[model samples]
Target: NSVSEYTKLQKEISSKRQSLYTLVESGSGNLTKTAIDKINAIRAEMSALEIKKDKAYKRLKIAKDAYADKIRSIKREELGQFDGRFVPELAIPAGTRYLANIILECKSYFGGPIEMNVWRGVAAYNCGLGRTKEWNGLPYIRETVLYTRDILYNLTRMLELKYAYSTGDSDLIAKTKRKMGV
Candidate 1:
């Protein structure tokens, strides 16, 4: 597939670019006339290769985009189970706090009442309503409010972590870690 081929070509292009840079730096010295000519020849070849690679990459992107659109259309038509308003069930394999945080992050983009399948909302409501008054003597009882906030924050970071990994964003990863106190 052109998608996979493009990925390979991109790697080749990156390597070639680095090689050209190294060759230029090495040729910066005041060497003999013959050495300078050879360096110039190499630069010219690299320049041509760069132009060729760029064209190939543009074509590759167009091809990949077309393929993805086709796939999405097919999926949308086949999955007629929902009115396109179904929220996928998310499990908090990690914890309720982490799940709540992720839900908060998702709500920012979708912008509405984010209905979580988890019982974190109920737990938070109970804590706020003093339903857990009988357990006041417990050490964690005083931290009920703080724990709820942490749950919301951790869930947000977890969602952002997936996005950062897909886009290769180190800055996003760092920001998410800082927010979650990771």
Candidate 2:
């Protein structure tokens, strides 16, 4: 049985308190010694089980946290060195479009003949500001697009992390399982 089962059993055993009291009243020293020994043994076993449980939980949490931190650091490094170059002219600030050209530029790059979202996300991340709010108001045409793409890409990655952790994404869960050799 598991720890919980053992715990319940301990409780049930202890519920014989009335009998123990009567035994004590009758001066039964042998029964008292046996009861005390059994209780101590159960407690020791429970303590060991709890310690093992704590260690396992800590190990899993540390492994997952380290993985997440590494991914974020990679994104930050890419965003720090981005340079926007392939942005479309319509996506430029001078264009008549109501919506900022950067968003369109990002869409173009995303849906364009070349399906390189990761590379574009990396470029966007590297060329643009780390913060997404910096992309507002069509700051630098190319720069904004780069930042926008990078932010979107990172958001997707974040969602993937949540999905994997919650077991909401089977593929991600499978990948994690493979990584952990589970």
Candidate 3:
């Protein structure tokens, strides 16, 4: 459930940091009114995200506590204490289901070959539907481009692994698992 939330927060932080850096760099000597305004806006966005991150951290702590409590309640031996490196997110599922729904939505809104629509949806998830529509496909943003590429590449590998499993070839399964780092 929190997978997308974490990813979104991380992307926003990177975007904001990059924007701030570019604005400051471009303003080298004289900071124009426009540049100052944009910098302020970026700072405001960063502040908002900081608050969001704080809330998310609190939620993470709550999740950790709940997980520990559940573990303690088990009838088996006491697990003792959890390490600082321990995270409850390991038990959480990925946002694949939500992203799948978004892909379907994109297909409905932007009708095209399912393959093209899937790319559009993936890009939309990285950026936004509005941005994707404006670009008529994936936006030129570097982060979005890489995000889409990585996701699609992983998905392709997943499909290949699935097919390998269906084939029931132990050799193929072993090779696929090794390739996928499974």
Candidate 4:
């Protein structure tokens, strides 16, 4: 993991610093040319390691964006209403794809799929919708709610479209009024 890699690099830097300190603390009236060269070499190594860490971080970000784009493209192509209705295909938004990835990660963390309701509820919880207690009665980290609202909003719109098409009603206003007993 990136965190572990970061920790390892940090430890290496600290060890190098300690070694340099020990060399300096020794009872030597003046530093020799060889000692100076060794110190310079350690500093260069640390600088190179820092650069490598930065590059790794950038690569991770790029990979995540690419993965999300791939997910979005796949969902856009494959997702549709299958209620024996001629529902037109719709495009999956980028935000939805990103949230879906997060939901998938969460699902993987908790083992495979259990049930549809469970999956939806967990996905909702992951996206920061309903309270964790109300969803699956599991404690979720507050920080994990970052993308929930956007994902849920986009998903709701998609569902509405699917429902509208399935029922042969293209008018959402009329559907809403009928459902509300207006």
Candidate 5:
């Protein structure tokens, strides 16, 4: 399935990124010409894999949308709102759209919401410490950890603000208040 392929490609990308980080941190001056050549090769391969991943994602999304449209058509017919040739556009709210993308990106690595939060926390901790540290008790590179932390933090903050405004949830509001030390 495309999902499994996407997951594999994501892992490959992560590995390649870590490898690239290691090479940069280790200093090219100490590396043999062959090692430098290998690094360039890895970089090129990573770029190609990224392009492949994007194509795979597009295919997956199209498949999902087709299935959803079919289900929606059936429901609309049952509700007496269907026309033979008309399909409604998929109109997701901006906040929900942003959150969905974040979930997808995280799920490629971390799976569900709770696991995603744990991953975020680990990244933040590593970033703040200014060194590579254990994530889920496994070593991760510092640069990637910091990048992941920023993405998670910004996405989480955006979702929290959106949900707090729309739902007026006391827990969300209180969490924000505590963050601001109110």
Candidate 6:
């Protein structure tokens, strides 16, 4: 059943992909969105395992960042703008560092509470500083909106876990861990 279902979804995605260019060219606003969403839904269903794995990876990243206190916010004097060069193919750490720097810069530019700044900075990171500022927070684009929402949710969860740890609340710790799927 699943194999057939997967094949069925694949065919659906293929057909949607075929129409996507036509939809774009014709400027069929809502129809284009409908087709894109349908294709994405099928892809998402197929990528469920990948989503789980990605969450696990995010948890590991959080743990690594916390355990080492490895990446303090880059100093204000040192936050440099991206030079539009060096897109490191295999250097994840380097790429993360670059993204983190952009976030720090965006936070400083936004000039609010640290937490809010981080949130805004992340939105800017996904979209762009100019776009995020123009929208006066998160842009209306679906991908950026979801990306920012997920990051904020993860950050909140991380804070809750830290509180649980600090307060010696085993029950909260266990509950949070369960929520975190780890």
The candidate that achieves the highest TM-score relative to the unseen native structure: 3
Point out the higher-scoring one by lDDT: 4 or 5.
5
lDDT of each: 0.54, 0.49, 0.76, 0.55, 0.63, 0.64
Question: Over the stretch 8-68, how does candidate 5's per-residue lDDT look in tens digits?
Answer: 8877887898888888788846888877898999999999989998998988788777765
Prediction 3 global C-alpha lDDT? 0.76
What's the TM-score of every candidate structure?
Answer: 0.35, 0.23, 0.47, 0.31, 0.46, 0.45
Task: Name the lDDT value of residue 75 in candidate 3.
Answer: 44
| TM-score for candidate 4, residues paired by index | 0.31
Of the candidates numbered 3 and 5, which has the greater lDDT value? 3
RMSD of each: 20.8, 26.6, 8.7, 16.0, 10.9, 13.2
Candidate with top lDDT is: 3
Query: For residues 1-182, could you state the per-residue lDDT of candidate 2 as single tens digits?
Result: 24345444434333343344444567655556776776566566656655665565566567656654654466533643433221233234443242234345554644653333334433444434222224332223343456656666675766666679897778888886575465
Report the C-alpha lDDT of model 4 over 94-180, residue by residue, as the tens digit.
445655664665465445574333444444545343444344534233323334445556656667666766786658757754664
Model 1 lDDT per residue over 1-182, tens place: 56566556545554555555666678747777876676677667657756766777788888766755654566544545433323123223334565466446445533557664223343434243233323331113323546666665665677777776787788877886686677
Q: Relative to the unseen true structure, what is the C-alpha lDDT of residue 3 in candidate 4, on a scale of 0 to 100?
A: 46
What lDDT is reached at residue 182 by model 1? Answer: 76
- Which ten contiguous residues of candidate 3 have the minimum total lDDT? 83-92
**lDDT of candidate 6 over 1-182, digit per residue (tens):** 33344434444444444454455566545556676686576556546634554555566666655633422344433324322222223345765786687677766777766666777777788768887788787766555778989988888888988988998989989988998897
Clashes of 6: 0
Model 4, position 99: C-alpha lDDT score: 50
lDDT of 3 by residue, 104-181 (tens): 877877887677788888898878888788777877676788999998899899999999999999999999999889
